[model samples]
Target: MAIASMGTTVLDCPDPRTLAAFYAAVLGWETAQDSDDDWVELEGPGGYNLAFQRSEGHRPPQWPGTEHGQQAHLDLDVPGDAREEAERQVLELGATLLQGDDGGRRSFRVYADPAGHPFCLCYPRPQDT
Candidate 1:
């Protein structure tokens, strides 16, 4: 009795192919065969899909501010032990850190993609016993 099932999540960017490649690298996904210049799709594991579409006047959002604030963002999980390596990989893959460790207090670090969309690399919190 649901209205519809899940579909691809699309991000508007200046160049679809380039953005798609970036996400593909970050997510370890593969580009769909039907992707093209104006629109590109990535086939993620578990039937999930992510896509990028060309926008002539795309403006990346400003995080932690009201002006052009974040419309949406992805929260990717990283194991506690691999957090440093994950951060290194993302930074090498064109992600810029917006916020980082606060004396080991926070469980997540914020970052912006090459196009300035904000996303977080979240680490698992210690469970109380």
Candidate 2:
């Protein structure tokens, strides 16, 4: 028997609604809850729910190791050839690219959302035939 099921991922940011909106556009998800200014959620397909919480002085994490470390990050995948378009879309949706296909052998690109939470756009790994 299974012990648990999946649940929503909650993030902390300065503005919940603003952060949710940015992810909404990126994931094609819609706002699930917005009763208060401190928290909001976006419901995406496949039972994925992303929530945001308001923090009084939310200092975004600085990736690549600084005094502040990366707490967590989200990973979204795209088809192999769709990487370029995906990169453009994320950029337009307010994601700042941290690292990308700079002619490297890496399979994923790192970015930070509007609230400076690090996330990644990755190409799904190939399946074994």
lDDT of 1 by residue, 47-118 (tens): 999999999999999987879999999999888888899999999999999998695688899999998899
Q: What lDDT score is found at residue 15 in candidate 2? A: 96
The best candidate by lDDT is 1
Whose TM-score is greatest here? 1
Report the alpha-carbon TM-score of model 2 versus the true structure: 0.88
In candidate 2, what are the lDDT values of residues 1-129, reduced to their tens digit?
Answer: 989987999999999989988988888898975537888988888898999999999999999787777789998888867888999998998999998756646778999999999999988544411
Worst ten in a row by lDDT for model 1: 120-129
Model 2, stretches more than 4 Å misplaced?
1-3, 102-104, 124-129
**Overall local distance difference test of candidate 2:** 0.86
